[model samples]
Target: MQNNKKVIVGISGGVDSSVCALMLKSAGFDVQGVFMKNWTNSAPNIECTTEKDFADAEAVCDQIGIPLHQANFSGDYWDRVFKKFLSDHNEGLTPNPDILCNKEIKFRAFLDYCLEIGADYIATGHYVRVDNSGSSARLLRGIDPTKDQSYFLHQVTGKDLAKSLFPLGELTKEQVRQIAKDNKLITAGKKDSVGICFIGKNKYNDFIANFLGKDPGAILDEEGNELGVHDGLMYFTLGQRQGIGLGGIKGKEQDSWYVAHKDTQSKALTVVQGRDHPLLFSDGCYVEDVQWVNENNQEELNCEVQIRYQSQPVKAQLKKLTNGYKIIFASPQLAVTPGQSAVIYQGDDCLGGSVIKDRISSDFYSWADNRGYNYQVYG
Candidate 1:
């Protein structure tokens, strides 16, 4: 049992965090709950749940008999996260801001704030574990495989992991909910939040349009044939299969269309006939801004990689480059998207990750070159 070591618990007015604080307090640690206000104001038509969320957090703190605190990191979030989100989208790549928030806010800024406030460590509701008994701290996948969030936390370093606690790592979502119910926590019945946190329960395109105005452009097929006019390239992502205003084509109506490429320079969206289209698959991709949670990352290693959160990890080989790393899959993977984190894992321990730059396969290059597209595929 922790002997009254002061720790700050980041409560999000959710069952997971509320349970996190309760479990810590039960363990005899001096626990305090702090609600981080990430998004301060929202555009018109978008619902801002900050006030409601804060009240819920206060209720849970009261129920647990712990003092609650609040921190406004909205300015930090806007400068560090939201701007980058808009920049990536404007460049036709869909970036996950949650990953950025975890790196910059929860673990970086929030951790700093907690440490400055005299807390020994900061805890959160993240569904991942950290093994600090090692030579250096190591991040492990949560016991609950279905709710594991290690993929979204690849940017956190070992130094930060050593000072962090994940109370819900050993518990599944159902187990957490049941524990909350048994304790009569206020958040036990609250629904889990989904999608982008800032734009809660609002139309995605509508929220983005407030920042990035619409720029209508021609949507082209793989063969460079104009198909339709797109609202904007920022609204589409790699492997997107719907909401393209597409209808039954003459003979290809039976086959579904998928976004194969987004040409930001030409302001055109390239689509393909079927999910199995050759353009949608790539042998590997070049990743930039690679971050290694483990201090001693090998120059070359064979490991499993997950390109997106929901996708399963597949066999891959990582080779160090002068600037970044090139990840080659055992087999061609579909929709190797840019601006998405490609997290590396050796067994259940998260090694680290980098943003997918672009496809390095010859097929992708040949297709883009043959179409007279002008974009640097490599440095």
Candidate 2:
């Protein structure tokens, strides 16, 4: 059935991508493997991983009997994803670099390479599915909620969705592993990769220190009282509960500290004692730089909003803002961290998403009152 169809699969030495290639080969498609070289050189603490990844990809291709190609995308990765990551952190936002890497590098650069090579379609190991039956293709969540990567793929356009293929979408992680084991793929037993792809498994604080100099900041309590010291404000993210060395909270006892506020002006990190703290929860969020796949009905609409990758879907009212969109959640969500994504969904289909610029707390008015800031409450 897939005899004459030319398909290019992105093989990242990881099991997911390796299994994607194997599946395409089993489907009888004219499969070719392309290993994307995203980083020019591996950073500190992550040396030779990319090289190892390349070797694994090549091994998979050799075992699958397919021609393999490597494309260098370091320039684009630096200009597009890494630069934005730094900018967001400087502004006190918690940016998801993986999402940007997918949007800018994988789908854009890798797809362009596939097209240049005369491939009919480009496939990846993303857990999300694509439904092209309607007027336009729609990206849907993967069957495994735990492994669903649709949140990171909200930036994919309809056109991109139409030409893209996610072979592992219908299968669960276990199923993918089974397929690899059955086929005796080299990465069959490899552990799943975590954290940012380029940054690898190092401490985020250490990673950021390489690019941006370390600027230690005071860690404060909800009342702005200094409690401890953090390596840097950029190192910590909102909703983070651990790694904070507060003296009073001896050895993970007392109360868990959640990042509540950050002051870029004063370089201060404000934290709350407990997850149930009202100041850490938010009822609404402001998203900026919104992009949609299907531009047919670009008007504001009500849909489900996913603030973070594992967050349960929530009903939200969306209105187009001058720069982006204002999303009001049905209930207060805890730790609505800025610099993360606010992906919108309709049923199982991903609508679109944007970076979170600001958050509105349920007790915002009360918070302002306590802070003595004369802020008006707008409906």
Model 2 weakest lDDT span, ten residues long: 370-379
Each candidate structure's count of clashing pairs: 0, 1
Q: After superposing candidate 1, which stretches have Cα over 4 Å from the reference?
A: 375-379
Summarize candidate 2's per-residue lDDT along 1-379 as a digit string, tens digits: 7879999998898899988888888889999998888876545554437888888899989998998988899999999999999988877778899999988988898888889879999999999999999999998999988899999998989998898999889999999999889989999999988888877666677777877787788887766677777777888887888777765654345777788777776778878877898888888888886778677356568899999988898999988766677889989998888889999898998888888878877485576577554432333
Candidates' TM-scores? 0.97, 0.94
**How does residue 142 of candidate 2 score in lDDT?**
95
lDDT of each: 0.90, 0.84
Q: What is the C-alpha RMSD of each candidate to the true structure, in Å?
A: 1.3, 2.4
**Residue 225: error of model 2 in Å?**
1.8
Name the 10 consecutive residues with the lowest summed lDDT in model 1: 370-379
